[model samples]
Target: MLRPVVVGLDGSRESLTAADWAAREALRRGLPLRLVHAADAPAAGGSDLPELSAPRHWARRILRDAMDQINERYPRLYLSAEQIARPAAEALVSAGGAGELLVLGSRAFSGFGGFLAGSVALQTVTRVERPVVLVRADQTVEDEHTPDPEGRPSADTPYRAVVVGVDAVRPAEQVLAFAFESAALRSTPLRAVYAWRLPMVRAVAEAGAHQTEEAAARRALTAALAPWREKFPTVEVVEQAEEGHPAQRLLSAAQDAGLLAVGRPIRPARLGAHTGPVAHAVMHHVRCPVAIVPHE
Candidate 1:
């Protein structure tokens, strides 16, 4: 059986927006949609306490409201709702592990020029083994497609490309696979990007040396993509080998992209959880949905 597309809700507008995005994706994948809400369990022997009643009611309301909105939007989708009596991060981690992927909402910082990824969402994303997609509240279906000839947002236009960052020296198969599959599903192009910085040596900064390094990077990128290109012959692949920071180049390439996917190495528990600098920067600033895929 195919795993369901799960979304975490918290009665916030952002979470509701995420549910809408997840429903659309679930429909595309021909999978079920699961709506989940996490709340702290009531105090010991205080299940019926007057103070605890409101929160319990609120949790149920959150789930019901989200269900109603999604059902109205996608009448034919297979959907389910669950309210977990646990902390937000723990509940999301467990629930996401049981699904194909997890969708969560991230609030954009108003004047602060970045995403307001909360603690619970960040924690779950960094710890979960499955892919986690973070959607902003302002996202809409039209944003996934190219603008109409009139320069107006329209969903009927072709989908924008899906962008993925690749490291020529240490490429992860999981990240490449996810990116290619996403482009195939959307019937859009897949852009493979690799960026690097010149060594501190002055000799390497010469025009001749720069050309040599760029040639090497491009050759490695082509070599790394050979197998996948063969496997996904229909996907139009565009390779960009640039000299710069990975995050900045990715952001520029993804300006008009439908989705941006990046990988995170699964670290041992003793090492603690954290998003790498590349993932961190994109998550905060990218306009499109960011898919964080965990790989070994």
Candidate 2:
């Protein structure tokens, strides 16, 4: 059976937005869409107030409403909804097992304030092996598309490039593959960004060595992407080497990108879900959708 694209729904605007994004992605991949809700069970020894059951009812209602919207939007798309009695993170991770991709929503802060990804999103992204994408509540389809040359809004505009962070010395194949595939799917260019700065202690020793360092970084990125280029011959690949923080570079590159792809090394369950600094930074700051891919 084909794996479906799963999305976690909590009735929040963020979640609804993610569901819509997932629906469009499902259509693009020709996969089914599954909406999941994790309703926290009532606490034990709690008073049997008549309103106690309202939580369960609300959860079901959320699922129903989301299903209706998605069904109406993608009438031909196969969709299903389920409400599980468990922690949100646990429910999402379990559902992710059978999913081709798992999507969750995030709420962006106002002004220059940073957004919060919530613990559920953090936990799910770290634990799930499948690629998990986080979409901000205010994101629109047009946000993923490029603006007209004259800076006017137009639906006919093509999508912006797909940006992927690369660790030249230790590039992750899973991350590279996903980035290339996304660019190919959208018929957009792929910008592979590698960020590096000489260690403080080596700064003096490496003085006037910026050119050599940049050359090496570029070569590393090119070599790492060689196989993928062959696999995706049509994708226009751009290699960018920047001397700065990886997270900052990626965030800047993603300003106009349709999607930003990053990798999180999978650790044993006992180690817990560590998102690492770079992935953690972008998940909260990037304007575009962020795909957290787990690699061995």
Task: Please tell me which predicted candidate would have the highest lDDT against the true structure.
Answer: 1
User: What's the lDDT for candidate 1?
Assistant: 0.91
1-296 per-residue lDDT for model 2 (tens digits): 99999999999999999999999888878899999999776788776787988888899999999999988988999999999889999999999867998999999967742356998888899889999999999888777788898997665788789999998899898999889988988889999999988766566676667777778887888898898999999999999988999999998898888899999999887877788899999988887889998888
Name the top TM-score candidate.
1
TM-score, one value per model: 0.96, 0.93
The deviation in Å at residue 104 for candidate 1 is: 0.5
Q: Name the weakest run of 10 consecutive residues (lDDT summed) in model 2.
A: 107-116
Q: What RMSD does each model have against the real structure?
A: 1.4, 2.2
